[model samples]
Target: MNLETDLGGIKLADPVVMASGTFGYGFGYEGLIGPGDVGAIITKATTREPWAGNPPPRIAETPCGMLNAIGLENPGVEVFLSEYLPRLRKSGAVVIVNIAGRTFEEYVELASMIGTAKGVRGIELNISCPNVDMGGMQLGTSPDMVYKIVDSVKQVTHLPVMPKLSPNVTDIVEIAKAAESAGADAISMINTVQGMAVDIETKRPILGNVFGGLSGPAIKPIALRMVYQVYQAVDVPILGGGGIMSAKDAIEFLLVGAKAVSVGTGTFINPRLAMEIKAGIEDYMARHGHTGLHEIIGAAIL
Candidate 1:
């Protein structure tokens, strides 16, 4: 419906947003999407320093989703703040820079950098980055670690903070509450679930990284469920991601309590997805006689 929505202190023109990692720097899809068409543009998950990322052949397709181990490749914070933000300043987009780190100190440092950055509206703490040593899913599975990392970032940044949750956890609600208590302004879920695909002939994992996060339509149901449960557990805003593509899919997230929903692999399939979903959501809202998107949060019946 009238998907004009607000999360935390960030005002969104519509509830449709571009997920991190999928949308590179704002300029990558410049000609494809109008800068003002969607709610926000979440840049690639950035670390404190530049990363070359995992080896090639880092993606594999599942029945309905895709597995990826991009290793959070980014041009480091300095380059992003100096070069990228200057270019994105003209895009008229609400830039929410997603920050990730291997340690609490790194998290605080990244948040400090963003707190002083000029062109960004908010910060997203990416606590779900699979650890290279802990087998990837360790950090996301614990409630205490979730709280500690969120607190570290929150203490350093004045900007609204949103923690991206991992769906690989046994209890997402517990982690969501920890984030809220740690002073996160909002929460976004679920990050890709850990998955692996095997090459029959090679008898080895298809992704060069061996294990990766699964995304696309196949993860929608699980994402929706996590959003619903997390929404029930906390009062802070929730931005749902993972496999949302169309307006109807976006609405499903809204109905499940997502203040906004982000498009990831969906954009890979169609660059114009943000515009299409923006118009489609508005039209759907008007037809349904909805004056605002807030009314739809948690509208789903068992």
Candidate 2:
């Protein structure tokens, strides 16, 4: 079966993608899965300047998910292009850099700088990072702000630009529409839902940042509903993801209308999950009498 798919201007050999932050520049999983193993690898969230990240206790585990306030930690874009990108290129992974910024100008600058950098297949604008004190979810919540940022960035980057939307908004579909109106090549749905965990004994919050992006299976349903809603509303390709722990979860997203899916926190439990999911998707296609992934992409939508 042909598992090939496309995310805007970038094409994929399959629908499995190593979600940003979880894959860590693709080199982190070199021993477990090769660059050609899955469709793509979205690097850790990069910033205009290096971030120290949130303090101790930045990660806390909940019932069926993980809460993180890593705070976009990275060696600024200059270091990324000079150091990380070359190593990622050498690893042969199809690189899609995930970028975040503290200001509107920062967003435009990072897109321009990274889009022109060699070895990058596309860019995923992380306008929905909720762990930080500024920019991230702030610039993402409003349709007007979403439009302005995307439209401005579109002017500078030649590569396909996809704005990853935050799930914290009242109406995520409106935000997705704003992005498409601004000429977004595609839309990446449901960046971690805003949530927090607490320490019962200490009577305090568990995360160092007090609040963090909640990921994993607990948010999967919310992610699915958002992707389904956006799919019905937008014309651009959707990279559907959130809480995908197995092949079953990935397939569910495709049924709802995601052209491709990104596997995140699930990788922490199984570094080889992407490959496993890819195989499972193929098995599903065969049993379902589907010859191509497109045949199953949005087959369940009604």
Q: Pick by lDDT: which candidate is best?
A: 2
lDDT of 1 by residue, 4-70 (tens): 6777888898888889988787675657786687789888987889988999798998999999999
* Model 1, position 191: C-alpha lDDT score: 87
Local distance difference test values of all predictions, in order:
0.85, 0.90
Clashes of each: 1, 0
Instruction: Spell out the clash pairs found in candidate 2.
Output: none
- Score candidate 2 by TM-score against the native: 0.97
Worst 10 residues of 2 by lDDT: 128-137
lDDT of 2 by residue, 42-148 (tens): 98999999888888788989899989998888989999999999988987778898998877788899999998888999999998743244524577998998899
| RMSD score of candidate 2 (Å) | 1.7
Lowest lDDT sum, 10 consecutive residues, model 1, at 130-139
